[model samples]
Target: MLSQKAKYALQALLALAELDEGDSLMIGDIAEKQRLPKRFLEQILLDLKHQGVVQSWRGKNGGYALLKSADKITFGEIVRIIDGPLAPLPCLSRMAYRKCDDCVDEERCAVRRVFASVHDATTEILDSMTLTRALNGGEVRELLRGTG
Candidate 1:
């Protein structure tokens, strides 16, 4: 399951992708528009800024904006940043690997193989999707639910 932080991060990014021309947005504005809490939004944006996914501006007209093109940022990247890994289990994870302790036959684990396929499919979907694509794909509600 995607954490709230991950979902909020994506929502905020999609909101910015609507105007991905390197313009800043007040954190409060993104919160209200995306139906997220102000302080929480601020924290997520801060973390994203730290990751260099988004940049911040300071002053009367300051807030947040994508550091890179919205089309260049992948959902998988952000999800990895926020949720840690895309795989269902640590042993199945390619990016963040950790062998399971109790597994007797990791070499022939059918469940691990199944999860690997699922992870691969998920990776394919998210890697191909960018914030701009999600925003331009359809209405915000549909995009959030990932179906229209």
Candidate 2:
């Protein structure tokens, strides 16, 4: 499940992505436009800025904006930043993998095998999806329908 914080972060980023290049949006404006909590959005933006996903300006005309192009920012990156590893279990995690104490043979563990497949598929999809694709609602739907 995606955390509310991560979901909000993506929403905020998408909104910023819609703006012209080099344009910044104030937190109040973002919260009002996206129907998000202003205080919560401030924190999310701070975290994003710290991670280099966004850059902040501190002045009268300052706000938040993407540090990179929309296509360069993957959903996987945002999710991992806000929600930690995407793996269902620590044993299946690539970034934070830990062997189960009770599992003697990871190679033959049926649970691990099943979840590993699921994790691989999920990771591939999320990593491949960028904010640009997400913003293109019509094109994305058409592409998905065609793929299906």
Candidate 3:
């Protein structure tokens, strides 16, 4: 399930993605435009900045912008930044893998096998869905339909 924070972060990024080259939006403006809580957005943007997804400037005309192109930023990367691993089980996580305490044989575990396929499919789609693809109405619909 997508966390509220991750949802808001994606909303905010989509807003940023709409900006013209070299332009930026203030945090309050982003929150207002996206209908997000200003305080929560501030924290989310800060985390994204630290993760190098965004860059900020401080001045009368300063604001925030994507550090890279929209097509270069994938949904999987953003979700991982905001929500951590996409795996259903700790053992299935690539970045944060851990052995399940009760597991007797990981390779033979039916639950693990099923969820590993789930994780792989999920990550495959997500990693391929970039912000540019998301911003396109047709692409978004196709992706949701599992036909992209």
lDDT of 3 at 132: 82
Which model is ahead, 1 or 2, in terms of lDDT? 2
Clash number by candidate, in order? 0, 0, 0
Give the per-residue lDDT digits (tens) of candidate 2, residues 1-148. 9999999999999999999998999999999999999999999999999999999898998999999999899899999999999999789988899999899899999999999998987787778778988887534344444451
Candidate 1 or 2, higher TM-score?
Answer: 2
Model 2 misplaced regions, further than 4 Å: 138-148
Tens-digit lDDT track for model 3 on 1-148?
Answer: 9899999999999999999999999999999999999999999999999999999999988999999999899889999999999999999998899999999999999999999988987888788898888888536456757887
Report the Cα lDDT for candidate 3.
Answer: 0.92
Q: What is the C-alpha lDDT profile of model 1 across 42-78, one tens digit per residue?
A: 8899899999999888999787888999889989899
Kindly state the number of residue pairs that clash in model 3.
0
Ordered list by TM-score, greatest first? 3, 2, 1
How many residue pairs in model 1 have overlapping backbones? 0
In candidate 3, position 33 carries an lDDT of 99
Give lDDT: candidate 2, residue 97.
92
Which lDDT value does model 2 have at 37? 100
* Positional deviation of residue 108's Cα in model 2 after best superposition, in angstroms: 0.8
